[model samples]
Target: MPKSKRNRPVTLSKTRKKGREHKEAIVNSIKQALEDYSSAYVFTFENMRNLKLKEFREQLKSSSRFFLGSNKVMQVSLGRSVADEAKPGIHKLSKFLRGDAGLFFTNLEKEEVQRLFEEFEEHDFARTGCMATEKVELKEGPLEQFSHEMEPFLRKQGLPVRLNKGVIELVSDYVVCEEGQPLSPESARTLRLLGIKMATFRLQLVCRWSPDDFEAYREGLDLSDVESS
Candidate 1:
């Protein structure tokens, strides 16, 4: 009888698992947004507010879709190179995905979209770790903005203060925050109590793309001036 062939050692296959259905879903949604609208835009935002964004979405629900997600995924959806660009010259948009960027798909006329973006502005209190856009200093005197009852709380927030005859008074000038520095927790709280809003929420149109054209829509134009003009 021939000797039984030695059993071969079992080896596992090196195939990786396919578990990224979520990324695929994101890509598909982006593609849908791209195809459903007449045009697409790349936008950048600063100090975004979720509720405000939701409100903006609702306001445009009938005519547009706004997509904020992974930049890499969006770039993939739009195409990384000219050969596979979602539309002619659309790959140019992928280059502007530098910061807090998102895609806006709309059927509204281009000028209308630009006007809407220019008009959109939200103001909010600066959070801790947010850079101060300007110096916030409290003069050495009574803080009339805050009531006497808030003196204790103000003191607790690290402000040099005391209740002098039913008034909250700062013992000396206090630098709550300095321009170009991250706002401190104490400073942020104090600023809020003083009713100071240092953060401005705004969206900017970086570029727009259509089947026939792709270009930077509002380069060097002051959005504020545009809105006013």
Candidate 2:
């Protein structure tokens, strides 16, 4: 039987890099989207939630494509200057891709895209380390909202909770969270249990680019920022 070369020794090199081919693929994909769509916009997001973003993507999947990845790859795809730009006036968007932003390619009319981006928002329970949007308190009384079985859990969450006659009771007024303060792990979990949503996920449109026109909708990103960089 011939000796099989299945057990080959692999190099344990420490210095290795990726994205030569991956970057090429991304560049191609962005170019294809540009060719298919009439307009492109740079959008920045806050309090990102993947599930919510997934739902939003489904809503516009038929008419739009969203790209969220390395800023470097995206910038390269759109080009850095007028000389090398994949599409005319698109390099302007590359200027605002400096932070928590993404590229959106869409076939929908400009008015429709503006409306959707303006109205799109999602609320979710705040997490630990997130600033509390408002103070959350519990009064000294029976907590009819929670079952008696939740007394231990509530107590563990730093709440003055007890179980009396199969009812969850708040023995004293307690503050689970305070406005402008970062939420603790216990407080975050407690807020979720109480069905309080304090975090908002939103995307802000920064600028729009097309074959014949370019406009920036937000301030703070301009040609000065581009020149300074």
Candidate 3:
């Protein structure tokens, strides 16, 4: 028999074990992301300098309840259905990961999430951002089917429209559609026509629980609405 050289076994130090534990914690967090999180939004920032990214991280740490991690790790941790559905979108996000990749998780109603996105659209760093992807579906029916009461109101918000190629086109340029931002001439007219009290940026309502669950959460009383017993 010929003598053979053997390699020594690798040993993990305390720091390495701690690192592994931390990674597992993050994975667990991602696994729980969809339990009560009926609403999830994926957004990417363009031209986000390191300082700005740090500031954004602090801002998100303030109110949201979610975890952000490497796409590959998160995809592996997520449920099969969620992972499958998000695969294409996650792939799209992989390109943006060079800068900063984040997932917003919440049980809040989709409309509320949309409002938050709009509210922060011009927060010095979010203007350049766009709604990367969403899961919510806006059903099509008669104009009245969706909601007509807001038509008159929306018309007043400065949003103008024209019949272009069998679709309504906001005659003016695109508007910020949110506070602290400028509006394009055409978007202004359309928004005014739509009577939007607030701006509707590219903020999209991504995936959410069924409409029924969402409606119940919306209508149910909150702590603010409760009286002392």
Alpha carbon lDDT at 194, candidate 1 = 75
Candidate 2 residue 97 Cα shift, in angstroms, is 0.7
TM-score of each: 0.82, 0.84, 0.35
Evaluated against the true structure, the overall lDDT of model 3 is 0.43
TM-score of 3: 0.35
lDDT measured at residue 71 in model 3 versus the true structure, 0 to 100? 61
Is candidate 2 or 3 superior in lDDT? 2
Worst 10 residues of 2 by lDDT: 220-229
Alpha-carbon RMSD of each model = 11.6, 6.6, 20.3
Model 1 local distance difference test score? 0.85
Give the lDDT ranking, best first.
2, 1, 3
Tell me how far the alpha carbon of residue 5 in candidate 3 is from the true structure, in angstroms, after superposition: 26
- Higher-TM-score candidate of 2 and 3: 2
lDDT of each residue in 1-229, candidate 2, tens digit only: 8777997888888666665897899889999999999999999998899998999999999999999989989999999887889887788889889789999999998899999998999999999999999999888999999887788888888888778899988889999999999999999999999899999999999988899888888876556755443
Pull out the clashing pairs in model 1: none
Cα lDDT of model 3 by residue, 1-229, tens digit: 7555575566666353346677778767754655545555555444334554455457665445544566656545542232353332222222222224456666666666666655643222222323312221112322332244444444455434334344444455534344444544534443334344332223322323332332112233242311110
Instruction: For each candidate in the order shown, give its overall lDDT on alpha carbons.
Output: 0.85, 0.89, 0.43
Error of 2 at 134 (Å): 0.9
